[model samples]
Target: MTSTDTSDTSVLDDPVGESLRGRHAPLGRTLGRAAAYAQDVATFSAVPADPTAADWSDLARLLGPGAFADMFSCPALPPAGWEPVFVLEGRQMVWPDGGRPDPEPAATGPDVTELGKADVPEMLDLVALTRPGPFRPRTRELGTYLGVREGGRLVAMAGERLRPAGWTEISAVCVVPELRGRGHAGRLIGALVTRVLARGERPFLHVAEANTKAIALYERLGFASRKEVTFRGYTTP
Candidate 1:
């Protein structure tokens, strides 16, 4: 159900934390001010926007010593012993409120299919080939996923991730390299946007700032950049 007002955008600031505390609570763990998804689901972890030392300690304990923490877009810095892993520049884009576009006709219908547990193998293979983002073995458990197939092989896909209250993040949008330039990514995203809007939640997503092509496609589909984000990962000590 809807956990927050659809127009309230504050929850977008701490999406991972909001998701863990709201819709994704069943798939997450928390200790003090720290929370993380199940090991196989996602590597994301969250703490207060202005985290204290104890918050860092709690997160480290929750993840166990030396575990990797994918702190998606949280600008707070961790304690010294928390070694930096990787950092990437990205931006959060959201569907304009009340702007609903028709789902791409070809993307729906028989060509696009709802993906489930049995499709994980193929999904992983697609992710490996496309390098969309941090997709894990149990990532599909987060929300609905859809894929397009041709020649009886999966060629493209997109799906939801990080449900923060009334917002659903459309993520893992990828296509086989050979199939690039086709409208598969846009069509899959358009279909997902319709699905998210149909459920009364708004659709949002993050894209690496360097990926200009993807950004252009998303903008063309009516998404607007809400904020710039620096995605960071760290090793807990």
Candidate 2:
């Protein structure tokens, strides 16, 4: 589902609007214009069976030149006249099997607990330590973030990103290098997904195209790739 312009004034007249409203009805009629544009915004999902030069041009216009490479999914080789500075391939993993999985049934440890705003500073540190992306100080404010603390230190964390219509993206998933393979990432995701389902919305996530290990983990968790997409960030020249 794609839309070209924002001229569709009425909420009923816009597909993006309809999709967003249908998915996030609980959010009520308070949809912000930024949210609406964000709903319509797509990078790799816009790839047509036979994309044209105009399509690339329009995509460039929508994303601008300063876009991040991880923000978009494009063909291995872009069409002529379209030169992508960088491309990141990722999959939009959807939970075909509804309902959150049982919450691990037991806690990993007393130190492994969910975090709140008070943990933001430590969460940001974990993100930096893991180097997930260009995380800002306020990024944690984007959604409900959960973490596991070991000895009162934040060691692993995961949280939400990109809210397109009914879909809630689970991103910024990272665990301290020392805590790798400890299932902390999974636990955080599981708990967070539980919250998303409780709100009656679906959960989805993205991973770098080259990340086969993470993909396998997600698949094991009942998430399947719906389609390949890209996250591209741009900057004005």
Candidate 3:
């Protein structure tokens, strides 16, 4: 991976917050310093960097009683009444400077197609089988999604999420278990990377630390680790 100045990484420190407040503002609900995506859009919620008591209260009110809040990579812990739901160790990886993917096969293959609302059912089915991450019915509304099909059945897919300032997150890159190691993921990600860079934004993604195979693929695709992160979720109190 090629080295580049990372002085502007502060925006990434609160990606969920930045996104909810910026490009995704219309798709989210904000209450004071607390904010979250609309129901069915995504489960991610956010608070100020140094959250106050009121911030937690606002988030709780926003999510209502006993709602699940996916605090993606937020460093602050919530109040005692908020129950921990899940936590995953992950890393933020960014496309390195001067890095570019070879032309994506999607450029020529009829199998690679842009997905839409009509594809959500199959997309959800794939997510259920792959456990890529949190993907709800409306999640695709967040950004562009692309999928690879085989004999008219969706098999592999990837898409954009969390547009934080000048960056776009490449997420939900998953392939069928039966089709593993076939370079489908790499192609999907490469296509998305090309699209992101073309629009004057950088590409980044999060991957579970235990998924070493994915980390290797990301590295091979010109992504370099920026920082370790803890993905946390909690129940609103």
Candidate 4:
């Protein structure tokens, strides 16, 4: 097996590469390489491969349906009521070169800032403003969350999730409907990406296949989709 120099922290210093590192690190070296290679092959079809269906099935059984449905569908196949059981997607790992220009810092609003643990109640309320699925009040414990507050009411927020060793997945990004189109989302992403870089980790994220607008935004932020993987599962009764 090829060895990765885990001690090499260069990738974690650049904003782009740092984000990828956070997402890739926690999976550990071996599993991270395996997952990346599998995604590459599955997407390009240059190599013939059949990943074990059981693996997906097991994850589906574990994560349940509501969460799974956001990513994929089982296509009316098997077990009569089989739902999407897993979510999978691919990202092109980006490394910053000297020639790459740094993104201009986002303009901040008076109310936008890093969130504190004391803000948990309001944070849940802000998350409710967006209606992301299966979010529990306690989900705040998952990772660092940042938010924008208006007169002390949490209005917009985004944060990290699904942390692997060197990589962290950016999830739970949203702003109130009334606040949309004001570049709040971009600012939140920029700030969160900055935090991820400071931690010596890389950042990555997943989006629904059909969300063209979100995909476009990520691309503008220097993320490129490298492969596609289906997330399959069903809702629990």
Which portions of model 3 miss their true places by more than 4 Å? 1-7, 103-110
Q: State each model's CA lDDT, in order.
A: 0.91, 0.56, 0.89, 0.50
Sort by TM-score, best first: what order?
1, 3, 2, 4
**Residue-level lDDT tens digits of model 4 in 1-237:** 113333343332232223224443332112211121112111110000222455335434433453322322122232335443555443323323211224535555645577777887776776677764334554455467778777767778888655545555577788889877677777777777777666665566767766677788777876666445454434432
Give one digit per residue, the lDDT tens place, for model 2 in 1-237.
223222222221122234334554333222122112232122222323344655545555544565432224323333454444554666667765354555443436534455676777787788778976545555554467777777777788788754544556687889889878877777887877777776666677778878898898788776777676655433322
lDDT of 3 by residue, 1-237 (tens): 212233367789999999999989999999999999998999899999999999999999999999999999999999899999999999999987546677534334436689999899999999999999999999999899999998888999999999888788999999999987777888888889998877767899999999999999898788999999999999988
Residue 103 lDDT, candidate 3, scale 0-100: 52
At residue 17, give the lDDT of candidate 4. Answer: 21
Q: How many clashes does the backbone of model 4 have?
A: 36
Top-scoring candidate (TM-score): 1
Question: For model 1, how does the per-residue alpha-carbon lDDT over 111-217 read when each residue is reduced to its tens digit?
Answer: 67899999999999999999998899999999999999988899999999999888999999999999887788888888888888888899999999999998998
What local lDDT does model 3 show for residue 111? Answer: 60
Which candidate model has the greater lDDT, 1 or 3? 1
For model 3, give the RMSD to the true fold: 3.4
